[model samples]
Target: GTPDAEEPTVTAWGLEGSSLRPGQPSPALEDWEEASEWTSWFNVDHPGGDGDFESLAAIRFYYGPARVCPRPLALEARTTDWALPSDVGERVHLNPTRVFWCLNREQPRGRSCSNYHVRFRCPLEATWGSWGPWGPCSGSCGPGRRLRRRRCPSPAGDACPGRPSEAQKCVRPRCPGCGPNTCGCPDHILLGSVVTPSGHPLPGARVSLRDWPGTVATSDAHGTFRMPGVCASSRANVSAQMDGFSAGMAQAQANSSMSAVATVVLNKLEKPYLVKHPESRVREAGQNVTFCCKASGTPMPKKYSWFHNGTLLDRRTHRYGAHLELHGLRPDQAGTYHCKAWNDAGAVRSGTARLTVLAPGQPACDPRPQEHLIKLPDDCGQPGRGPTYLDVGLCPDTLCPSPAGSSPRCGDAGSRCCSVSRLESRKVHCSGYTLPVKIVAECGCQKCLPLRGLIRGRVVAADSSEPLRFARILLGREPIGFTSYQGDFTLEVAPSTQRLVMTFVDPSGQFVDTVRVLPFDPRGAGVYHEVKAMRKKAPIILDARQSNTISLGEMGEEAPLAAGIIPPGAFRSADGQPYTGAVEAQV
Candidate 1:
């Protein structure tokens, strides 16, 4: 069979130049040449005999130019040859320029041959022919390495591929970081990547991050937040809530380093409501009063109504506003008032207020008068001029009729009849009445009236017959006059009368004696005298000069004059002088 095409193979090898400086490592090589045949000592026909390699030497050989070398050589190969081929070369020569070596051996004719018939194969191995300052090397190296390439340093200044240093991978935060107990951002905000429980980014959700002692922050649209100048030692707590979403919370530690992201979720909640009334009580008699109803609910009250006395009042009065104003009050309006507030959920009523009203003026009679009677003075003994008895009577008018069957009569006596008479005489029956009578005597030509009388007399003491000074002489019930130094008294009578009774009374109101008299005398210029009878125990008046002249006309008895009494200015018996004897008296 023709030679099978060489199986595809790859090899890695390195070569050093001869001119390389001391302590300098060589670079890795890129290319190589393939060997056709080789001979090995163990497979030789003579043991340990030098064989001729003329066929290998006479074969066409591709070679590279020689150059100065630095360190050593290394080669790595892979082949598809199943059994060793017989046409391989015995020895190989390395070339610096081409990065490959040629194999050579001696032939049987004791001369170099270009070809060999037996297969001789050897396993590939790297070769190092030189040494560097640190160690032997076969390829180029990275910066900061020893010429021998024994040890390499990492960017972090440690052994290559070891643990990183603090300057290499350790990172801290410029601002406050989040933690389990505090919000990483200022004003309780969440920072960095965050998600809800359902793994959706919460946009426009009010997320709050809080630190201890009431510091808080909010999250932005990116679900990231930061807090400036926050306490690094405080714990971070994050929360989020939105409409139609469940509320959620998360916690983190606020260390100087970066914090982990927190997740939040929100749930639904209920709202509270209230119904209130402003007034407490109402009065009877309905008044135009106002009622205020205040309602607070998640959804506000939609309707309001007022009730009075268990009946619904006019709905228009409640202005669909805060307060209800009622105009025009009435008595029927008095009742308990209350308000009701209603919404979609339900209705509520306020407490009742009681109301009241009042009523308006109403008529009445006069008082009666009492009856009384009074007596008039006895001195009023005249026919028409003297006072009359007071006939007390009850009349609507003071000018009403009297008891004497006359107009303007006494008010008390009504129509009763009465009578009056002379002093000390029997009372005569008359159609009208007179008051009690008072008697008086007149001394001059004028006849004496009972109350309006003028009487003249000389008053003397009964025992000594001497004129009394300042002696009081009373006529009837009234004191008429007083006695002068001459013991004389002149008094006017109240009424006109003929037969009179007189009494001598002293200042002490003592009565000496009562003498009756007629004022007119029929005799001519002869004084008539009347005397009181003297008692035996009283002194006898024997001296005629001491005797007082008492007029006999004032006497009460109807008696004849004494025998020698004469009338003044009349012929007495046949003599020319007036008569000194008793004259013929006319009846």
Candidate 2:
């Protein structure tokens, strides 16, 4: 089969938006033949003072003698703008084994070879050249990747069967106490941070050098710590410890040129603690009953074992977890049931709950409400001994029948909750007058949404009393509502919310973005919080001198030429507030 007329992968080199550079090459002026091996880009002369004279001997003289091919397979010649030798419209010479030169005298008056560079492609050995030496480790310390390369001998042939480039894991020798080339040296300061598993900064963590005693530091509220004279561009083993977390260690990356920063991640730990436990349930013999148990711990409990009358139940047959659903309950299955939660730290056994299964056609719930007592506030207490107590009454969570096609589905289908069906408003006579209280008078099953309480607040400027009106209210990142014109806002808190996280964004940019984590009451009770928003932009200092005029790099710097002038205060912090902290001017 004939070889594919593969075009040489010509890479454009030099300045952007420019037609010519000192010795830059054009992308399109290279040879179209497939390349077996290519010498590094060689340029022996510049397009200044005289015409560029890039001879083969000159390239070998400046570079190593083995850098150039004695006899070449193909040659490429180009101007910086991709103009080929034919299109250059100037007298020049490009010999594959000799030299690529251009004389100003030979070019048309006031013209030259557009600044040139050359490349040579040569035939190869069997399939590929021997693999080159492995490159330096990508990372200064610890594990990283290293690369080595080999060249296909014949680009015209089927790609030498395998990859031309290869990579492997690079392992640097671990340093005990800042040893040889393994560590970068001369760095002055070492900076590190301790964070929770969720990446939140964990303040108050004590950080100390692994082997250096008395060298201790503490993370601030931002979870960051600094150590001076730590690493001379050397690797430093650092560890962090806190009260309720596993000790975490990290290799601090430090070197001569910059301040070294490392992050130590701490895993919060706690013994298995039960948050929700199984409760006693009464159900008809043929009905289903479900008991749920939840445990909270670091590395959340994933293993739960249920027991029946002190006997461990077969997990393979039951296949239940935190929630155990028993279908077609039998009298024998009715007994004290409990669950044991296990985590890496420890295991906890939940309190036992009784499962009473009655015969068919039996009522599972009592119609009468239990007498529940409540404590009145200290100011509303009796003048005598203990605080006055009132019988507010209570409704148990028992199974009850549902009404005909009405209210929300209570518990599960065909089942309901024994909830407060009626409430009686009474007065508790106190020192001054009386405090009105609602007492549970009846218990029945209906629907259950249980109206949630409201979260009300007013967003206003922190420094000034100006209201932050019409700000978007985001609940768990979803748009829930907007503040009114008076900056007052209210929304019903979700029933399952333990932490109410909200973000208020000001579309008008008058206020910095505000994020708040509010305390929540699991019971249906309204919570009030005042939100103070910091004003956004601030007046910044500037250098108004004429010497501070920006020169916009007619000199060819990639950055804007505003070196002498104070930069505009257009920069913002990560939270979208006007940045007022320390900033590096060089950046």
Candidate 3:
């Protein structure tokens, strides 16, 4: 048999190995989903039939219009044995439009093209993911902005149609105005905090100026306060008082921002406590990751430090703070991480979290496929051996890896599947002959496409049973196909389509136009229907001076329900012109 013809060379996909960039991935991949779409794996061609040519034009010839997207973003190809083209080294041609590999076309004499399948990735649309948690404030004081972001629709992590992040003004209810003369506090504004004797946050406490009795500010839930408009002698003598404890006083060190630690501890001493801790993660090399932790205390623990595997992580390099962010992670970066919070009262360390990093070419999934048994033809089995069954072997339906790697997007990471990475051809003994069958030799991970559903039938006239040759066929208002000379037609039904509505028009005008609603399987099964059309009535001469009746048309043996009748002197021209020499009527 001849080889499968190649697709247009506008974009040739090189054999993917270590550089198989992906467009979509699995659940453990990204936190957000993509707006892009994918077609299910399709195996329209078999090795036994013309050596398995999975060309785009050939596929479109078999499956009709709209089965494939007009413009695809990416293409994936793999053999039935779940082997990638990169892993197998097949002389295959791949693009967004087609995936072609002919049996032994350019390989050794014994080599052949495996049964293959393919899928396409469509262009990104306007889909979006859920909004993420809000981030830390941009400023360390009041009226600063905090931001939260949402995920856009592309597997390639492309920017969305508009701004991906949303911002809102946020005022710190806790620890307001970190430094004096900052956060719009120019007049030596005093900032202080009130905490319980045991280091717990004192929600509602009052702090007032020593000289101005009415000039007071309440401590917020985070046990912090900020007050302005009081500039006397380079200091602010403020007193803190909570309902359960006695009054405590502290003088603000307004002249020095570094020494401006104005906190009124009810019992004089407090210990730091953990509020948030870092989380463990697994990532691939050359990717970015972040770890975060938080703490609270009497003096509001202002110092945060991070450690990796007992070694202190650099503050300037990793940006270690309440949040520690790492970029372009390498395999050497994998280790246990912890954070420490410190204040004058005491110091406390957070629980440790682990980080796992993988190399780019490493397989995250097992390369072996599971066992799958298939039954052969009835006559192929022995009389007492019951129905013949063979272990064809199959990979699980779950997501797997591919040489063309999966995108680390929201849907599925490594969008490849566990499939036949290896297979063998065999001949089984029948009663009088042998039947050739392909059995799974081995299975691994390969990308696959979904199948396209089909609808087929023939069109003919109701009276003479003649084929409705070359009639135009339309799905809705869009013309999709035409009947063959034998009146045979085929239609491909997309998975997203809910119903099939088609209109058939005869070019000869001898038959009336026909419209029908068809039923089909959404999961890529085939359906058939026979359409019957009615012939138009022939013209006949009529008398305008006497009563006359005319019959319209009929279907099968049913009575003709359409007709017209006229009495004498009823004939008249549409305009003021006289009637024609002969009155001709057709219904």
Candidate closest to the true structure, highest lDDT: 2
TM-score of every candidate: 0.17, 0.33, 0.30
- Estimate, for each residue in 1-587, the C-alpha lDDT of model 3 and write its tens digit: 33235534321233221234432222121322434556667676777633556767655434433566676655566778867654665556565655554545555466676777877665545557888999987655444677999977666665666777898755553333343322333444566778765566675888876544343789876787777644423355678876545567877765554334467777544577776667565566876666767777666788899887776765654556787777677776788989899976789999887777768876654556567788889998877878888877666654433233334332232335556677789999887898888877766666555546899999999878899999999976579999999999998886545457788999998888999998989778899999998888887898777777887566668998787677766664532233534587766
Q: After superposing candidate 1 on the true structure, give the runs of residues whose Cα lies further than 4 Å from its correct spot.
A: 1-275, 278-287, 317-320, 360-587
What candidate 3 gets wrong by more than 4 Å, as runs, is 1-371, 376-388, 396-418, 424-445, 519-529, 540-586
Which consecutive 10 residues in model 3 have the weakest lDDT in total?
23-32
Local distance difference test, each candidate: 0.37, 0.68, 0.66
Among the numbered candidates, top TM-score falls to 2
Count of clashes, each model: 116, 5, 18
Cα shift from native, residue 353, model 1 (Å): 1.6
Tens-digit per-residue lDDT, 15-97, candidate 2:
11123432344334343243346666777678876677677766764554666656666566666666665565766655565
> How many residue pairs of model 3 clash at the backbone?
18
lDDT of 1 at 364: 7
Scored by lDDT, model 3 comes in at 0.66
**Which candidate would rank higher by lDDT, 1 or 3?**
3
lDDT tens per residue, model 1, 456-552: 5565655455665676554443455666886665644322232344555455433344344535322212233323221113222222223222233
